[model samples]
Target: MTATIHSLPRKAEPSLEPLMTLVADGLNSVNTVILDRMQSRIPLIPALAGHLIAGGGKRLRPMLTLASAALLEYGGNRHHKLAATVEFIHTATLLHDDVVDGSDMRRGKKAANIIFGNPATVLVGDFLFTRAFELMVEDGSLKVLRILSNASSVISEGEVDQLTAQRQIETSEERYLSIINAKTAALFAAACRIAAVVAERPEADEMALDAYGRNLGIAFQLADDAIDYDSDAAEMGKDRGDDFREGKMTLPVILAYARGDAEERKFWEAAIIGHRTSDADLDHAIALIGRHDAVEATRERARHYAARAVDAIAHFPKSDAKAAMIEAAQFAVARRY
Candidate 1:
């Protein structure tokens, strides 16, 4: 599909810049802890982990952990190690995800599979995953482990479900939500919940932080799906139309197919479901998405989630960390560049 697109996410209630300042500094400290914790008997493990670790991502999960801990007034820097643990877990997932999806790029660079081979990349991902569990054990809390383990399970399940569900055309929003919650929001929920655990906060605060992460993650993934059609390869750091090529079921294509006129619907059936797609069919799909405003509609929904994520943090008393956490939620929605 070929069409122009535009989105101007509504302004955040509070500017995220000041909060990002604190988060930016904390990440360095977190990385240090992650590195120190990783010094172990298996030297190959670290070398393999290093290959993917060096690839830059947004670091959203670790940011949530540190910010949430700071909000609850954690005195020491324990959150730093935990934050790195969170990042390591997240990176491990990405490595496995790329392998599973046969992906070519991440953060606008060659995927580990391209550089290190799929087997090595897969093993490194395994190393990071185990290391994440090992690092979190230092917290000496089963609650934290439970959250992370559950997230890991859910993420795995989600990946499997998505593999089966993609390009099926019969996929529903209800099913999509289930898949994304498991695949995307599970980790996000864990990240925020772990911070609350670190603070020894009340259950209500923990639940709210969990909700914040869940909502933020959903919004982030939805926005990502919305952008896939026209995203610049350079900007997205990956191939455009990847979800389409892979026959993935994402919000834009689903809503567009549901709402499209007869001819447009046929395009989805022939190109997407039947895999009979030609350039003409592709362009038609793109046009129908724009005509029905599917992408914009998804963006609107994503913004609503971001708003809810910000509101969830209101339970904590205002602090630099809290503000940063809130801004991170806002950043999840509007951070296109």
Candidate 2:
């Protein structure tokens, strides 16, 4: 089946710059806490942790924590520690993920696992994970501990589910979404909701922020999945087709397989399920994805989620923080990287 390729123009969205500007002071505090907490008696631990943490990404997860706090007009220094904790959790997960995925790149450079070795990388990840919990305990908020700890468990479960579905072309959309929601959205929700909790906001406000972050997380992952097929390795800060190469059942692959003919199905089985893919087969897979409009479909799905994210926070009063949060949701789908 041939799908006519229609060019989809990129949508304009807010740069994270404005959000960074608004939260610059808070973010600085978060960074200071992150560095202080990452220190260890053993040199290799800090060295390896620094390699990934200092390598530089958007720091969006922690930024969400900061923004959510600011939106609630929080005045205490506690949110800084909480934001740092969120980043540590995120970074720790990335370290373990690189080892598990056998990935060679992260944030546009050699992965920590490759540089430090998998054993060292994994141990450092554990160290960071422990440090994150330490910070949570220092905050002395059982509610905060419960939310983040639960997110950590859900994230592990999501990764396991993804592992179980690896190369399984027959994986259903429901199953795929369940994995994304648990693996990706859960933390986003936790990060955002914790801000409201720290501020002692009403349950409704906490739920609204949670909804905003969860939907935005789903949109972010969907866009990332589409980008794997549409972009080059450098652009993505990792190898292109990493998902396909890893035999992960991302949305593009799922959508294409669902819409493909019997012959195409056989190709998916060999290239994905049977793990017999060659570089040439990867090229063909890209073609098949385009032919089925899988990337476009995935982008539209992301847009839908982004919209829902905006709606989730509709009741909040208009302010720079609120506007930035809404735009962050839009940027989830708008960003190419």
Candidate 3:
């Protein structure tokens, strides 16, 4: 009797390389627009903005715009400036978020506010927002203008809602989702939706892309939340345990709190209310999270949204663009840093 050798199939690692390659040319144009539009006669405007912009961000939002255009086979250059606009809006939010969170580090370096002072950092963020609007008006589409502007407003509202919920241990999962949907996912949705507008695709197609971006954004944020507490995870650039110190009720914290026993609940209540915030407290917090397997639970939630994101674009015909997008969603869940 002859026995055949058996081999198991290796799991394919998800990656953004395909998406990046697919959008390379369009991304170059968007980068040019970003570099040009971020400049100003006032030295501080460009100086402060450049600090964060040149920082090692993945530029995922603008890339999403380019990828959406690729998926639609849009042959126009209109998306270049619009993609830059989405990036400006996103950068502005990051600057302002760092200030609001009192963050000292961002993207593996000192935050802009730390180097430039909060006032200058804030003004530069405003300048970026102004540049974003200028790009929007130059795009000459009322629908595009409305979508991005509304997203900007929604992001502000979400930030405010999150602030109100900060250190409030009673924050429910429903409310947390609502906050991220606006603060993070709104720009993601707008970024992709505008591509459909530029392509002149029908409303249904636009909605499909919007759903894809929104769910992907949520998945990405959830993964970030899990990384913050994952003991074996790589450095995330931002200060580790910043969320715990800030008393931000991320999903992992929410889940851990919800599942904690009476003793564990007391520790969480104190931690969220700003009582327990030492390095040891963070370690204990991580311990409690591990005891309940909350980080993995958070990752599971991310996988759910990532699957929804993939399904959102299922009706689109098979192409490199579609396959790249599906992999991007998979990457969102698989990424640790």
Q: Clash number for every model?
A: 4, 0, 0
Candidate 2 lDDT over residue span 67-146, tens digit each: 99988888887889999999999999999999999999999999999999999999999999999999999999999999
**Preferred candidate (lDDT higher): 1 or 2:** 2
Cα lDDT for residue 182, candidate 3: 94
TM-scores of all candidate predictions against the true structure = 0.90, 0.95, 0.96
lDDT of each: 0.78, 0.89, 0.91
Candidate 1 lDDT by residue in tens digits, 1-337 = 2111222223545355655577777888988876775555767666656666766666778878877777777777767777888888888889888888889988888888877788988887887888788877887788888888888889999989998997788799889988998899989988888888878889999998899899889988988987786566777889877777777878888899899878777778766664755656556667788888988888877877777777777657768776666566666666553
Clashing pairs in 2: none
Tens-digit lDDT string for candidate 3 (1-337): 2111111111378789989999998899998999999999999998999999989889899999999999999999999999999999999999999999999999889999999999998889999999999999998999999999999999999999999999999999999999999999999999999999999999999999999999999989999889999834236887889999999999999999999999999999999999999999999999999999999999888888887787788889999999888889888878878
Candidate ordering by lDDT (highest first): 3, 2, 1
Number of colliding residue pairs in model 1: 4
True lDDT of residue 313, candidate 2: 77
Clashing pairs in 3: none
Q: Identify the superior model by TM-score, candidate 1 or candidate 3.
A: 3
